[model samples]
Target: YTEDEGFVYLNSIMDLYSRKIIAWTLSKTLEVEEVLKCLETAKRRRKTVNPVVIQSDRGVHYTSQKYKELTKGMIRSYSRKGNPWDNACIESYHAVIKREWLNRFRIKNYYQAYQLVFEYLEGFYNTVRIHSHCEYLSPDSYEKKYILEQTN
Candidate 1:
C-alpha cells in the first residue's frame, strides 16, 4: 500500500524450479489484464519449449477466460480454496519482501513502491540474497549453476 495510491497490486510469476521471479507487474488495479501482462512477460523471458506448469491461487483473475486462453497449452495448478500452504513458496516470498525491504520504507506513491521493489528484486533478492532452497546461492546464481551443469 502507498500513501497516494491507496492500495496497489503486485502480479508476479515465479519459476518454481529455481524459486526465481521471472516476471512481475505492479498495478493500481487488481484487473485480470495486469495478471495477464505478468504472464506474457514470463513467457517472453523464459521462452521454454517444454511444457510448463503454472500454479496460482483460485483468484478471479486466474480463473478468467483471458488467463485460461493465454495459458492454453500450459498446465494450470490451482490451490485448494482456503489452503495457502499449497502456494506457500510464493506467499513466503511476498511476506519476506515486505518484512525485509518494503516495510522499511515510507512509500509515498506507486513510483516509490515500484522503485523499492525493483531494487530489492533485481539488485538484491535475485542477485545477492542467498536461499537455502537454492543451495545458499542467489536465484540468478543458482539458475546459472543449473544451466552450466546441464551443458556439461
Candidate 2:
C-alpha cells in the first residue's frame, strides 16, 4: 500500500520459518537503489551467507539491474506474475503495519514516520507481537527458543 505523505516504499526481508521480519527499509520512492538499501540492511544485520530465498512481486524495482546485482550469487530470488500469496509473509507484514500502525496514527513528516517505524519494528514488533507460527511468541523469542532447542 502506498502512503499519501509520499510513495513510502516499504521493503522487508522475512524469515520463512517464524514468519518474522528480520530486516526492512522505508523510502519515499520505489527505486532500485532503495530496494538495494533494504537488502544491504538485512545483510548487515544477519552477517551470514544463509541461503535466503527472497520472494517479491513482479515489480520493476525487484527485477532491476541494481537489485539483481545485490542478490547476485548471494540470495535466491522468487516472484509471482500476479499473485500476492507467492510472497505472503512480507505481504502479511505490510498488512499488519497498515492495520496496526499506519492506520492508527498520523505523522507530521517523513522523519517522524521513519522514527515511528523504527520504534514499531525494533521496539515492539520484533519482541512483542504474538505469532501463531511460534505459538504466540515474538520473533526474537522464537529465535531464542529455536536456538535452545537445537543446542540441547
Best by TM-score: 1
TM-score for candidate 1, please give it.
0.98
lDDT of each: 0.92, 0.78
In angstroms, how far off is 71's CA in candidate 2?
A: 1.0
The prediction achieving the highest lDDT against the true structure is 1
What are the per-residue Cα lDDT tens digits for candidate 2 across 1-152?
Answer: 33447547677888778766777888887678877887888777777665666777777877788888787766555665666678777778888987898777766667777887888888888889989988999998999999999999
Against the hidden reference, what TM-scores do the models get? 0.98, 0.88
Whole-structure CA lDDT of model 2: 0.78
Cα misplacement distance, residue 22 of candidate 1 (Å): 0.3
